[model samples]
Target: MKDAWKRWGAEDERGALNLIGPDEVRRAVSLVKSGEVVSLAQPLSSKTPGPKHRCGLQHFMNRDGGDYAAGGRRPGGFQFSEDSVVMPLHIGTHIDALCHAWYDDELYNGFAGNSIRSTSGASRLGVDKMPPIVTRAVLLDFVQLRGKPLAADYSIGRADLLEAAAAADVQIGRGDAVLIRTGWLESQTGVTDVSFDIEPGIDVEAALWLAERDVALIGADNYAIEVLPFPAGKVFPVHQRLIRDYGVPLLEGLSLEEIASRKRSTFLLMASALPIVGATGSPLAPTAVL
Candidate 1:
């Protein structure tokens, strides 16, 4: 385990944070010694930005002569510029903290309130409460399990997940973060644009299955982890069920190519979500260690 920690570069925050305790390291060692494999989940993002996509701001200050600094140094004489961006929470590779979604305006176990709040309510479980998710992770390669890539318009049911797990020689477990690879990340380059016209993901049964297994999180390599073009006016029942009903987090738009390529089971699983107090979600780089 100590040896593994040494392999990490100083610039790797996730790896550095992971080295804090011996427990995670020991567990990782045990898995490796026992021949277990590891995988990382990628957040789904688009090349084309949308209303719900990611946005960022850049503040610039010219050192020669453009912006103004509070210090009043003439290095710039003038010194600041700002820019803004807008995008959906679902864009890029991100994790949907417990506050990411809600039920008929209520959250899991029926919290109160109308909007996302910091207290007990449907929108109360903001991303701020999400701690670092360091646990055992198992990858379910639906694409490989199916002997092909997940169809662009594919529908994943609980049964399909069961089949995928079997193919991977893995089983869902309590507190386990299950990452299902649909191989959809590769399709990003092929699409002319990122469209909501994309597909739906796991069905209700699969949602229930994850809930039943007591999974901490469920992730996939697609925009939304359920079949889309929703039947009628359904606004992502799967997300609703997991976040609002089961109180579980969901990760989407993950790139599992590296993990899938390993074709092994068990590994050190580590991931993070931004500690944005009032935000619904944040972008992050989740990784796996062998």
Candidate 2:
């Protein structure tokens, strides 16, 4: 293979002999302490979203600056910064928590209001219910496998996923944190103002396929995992199937070109997102190390 690893075997080989397993993930976690941290967030920028886009993040007041009095002596330097923000949690690079979705008003893991504590507000299952996740992650270079970016309206199916795995020569295991790279994130250049639209994304069946495989989470380089202009006029069937039905989290708006460059099947995939209580989603930055 043109991208085969040296230790894996000769270039003519179809697959690697040494595949990464769960033990590798445990060893990487053991090397880090509680305070030892890693940053995995893409900076929110005004330039990224175009003029037509609406992000209402105008500069208010920084915690470091401003005094108690009205426009009085500022404790810290009074720096005026500006930002644009929107309330859509699905906007930008974010991870959808389990509580972010519901089917028939019921959440994942079968959390019921009847079992809630007495004083809680409406006794709803929130993202806080999700415990810390530590699992094996597999990066699928879907774009590369297709020899181009995924079609704008291309429907990603289980066959495409299997083809990507075959092209990458990697085997996915149960509970794997699977990340699919579509190269769409790379197309969002400094000059381009890429707007959101219903485009290429996976169908509900594909979501069920991953869930049946017992995947812990599924991520993609696109805003929505399923192709846009969803089939049957559905908005986000992938999200509905995964988070609402299976309770699997979603990581979106990833920049995976650099990570996918190294064709290694086994690696320490490290990622962290903000622990915003009750929020539907939060920004994230995940990395894969060989």
State, as a TM-score between 0 and 1, how close model 1 is to the true structure.
Answer: 0.73
lDDT of 2 at 164: 77
Q: Give the range where candidate 2 is weakest over 10 consecutive residues by summed lDDT.
A: 11-20
Q: Write the per-residue lDDT of candidate 2 for residues 1-290, one digit (tens) a residue.
A: 11112332232111111222457457545433333333323456544452245453333344333443446454475544343444445555677765565555445545442433335422343444344455566777777777787767778788878887787677776657788777666666663647567446677777777777766678887777777777776667677677655556787776677656655444555666555555556665665545
Q: What is the C-alpha lDDT profile of model 1 across 222-250, one tens digit per residue?
A: 77787776657787878777766666677
TM-score of each: 0.73, 0.71
lDDT per model vs. reference: 0.63, 0.59
Off by over 4 Å in 2: 1-24, 27-41, 50-56, 59-89, 111-123, 190-192
Please list the residue runs of candidate 1 whose C-alpha ends up more than 4 Å from where it truly belongs after superposition.
Answer: 1-29, 33-89, 115-123
Which candidate comes out best when scored by lDDT?
Answer: 1
Error of 1 at 74 (Å): 10
